[model samples]
Target: MKKLTRLEKYHMNKVSQRSNGKVVAITPEAMEIEQRAIEREKRGHYRVAARLWLQCMDVASGEVERARIAIRRQQCITWSNHTRQGEYSGIGCRGVVYD
Candidate 1:
């Protein structure tokens, strides 16, 4: 079997946690991170975007950013819980939540 490339590995890492029969919300913070990334790319600030993106993951700080990240992480957990419970109620829950 061919080994996964770096890009594929990155994609897989992001999705792996969600593949275990659970939902994951993208959250406003994550969306903001993504938006910033896009803006950075547009302004040719790819390195800055990359740094910000990494900071958005699992660990981040700054009172404001920390709060935002915590809220988003909670949203992701809530989403997964809702999805699991929905399975019992027969409601089809699909996709990430970001608002």
Candidate 2:
């Protein structure tokens, strides 16, 4: 699993702080959109999920929703990098020997 970066942790902490000590229900429209995006992603529709996620960011009205987007976005970036690197090259050792 990819480890969370310091920035990611900071962002998460900020979001948690903004929750105001209560749970809020998202609007049906927003929930529908987010759910659709997740379903599309499960069906291998990456671009659709990506676009929906961006839309969610635009429509999100509260800190909780905004934080969800930020966290998911960061996770996507981390996963993308990890997958891409593994596909292109295997991890190798780096060291110097005295000549």
Best by lDDT: 2
TM-score of each: 0.33, 0.49
lDDT of 1 by residue, 3-72 (tens): 7799966654444443433222254565666566546646755456556555575444233444444444
When summed lDDT is taken over every stretch of 10 residues in candidate 2, the lowest stretch is 84-93
The number of the candidate with the highest TM-score is 2
Query: What are the RMSD figures for all models against the true structure?
Result: 18.2, 13.4
List candidate 2 stretches off by more than 4 Å.
1-25, 77-99
Tens-digit lDDT string for candidate 2 (1-99): 567799976654465533543222254566667777777667756665667767776777666666776565555545445443333233453554333
Regions more than 4 Å wrong, model 1: 1-25, 59-99
| Deviation in Å, model 2, residue 52 alpha carbon | 0.7
Backbone clashes in model 2, listed as residue pairs = none
Q: Tell me the TM-score of model 1.
A: 0.33
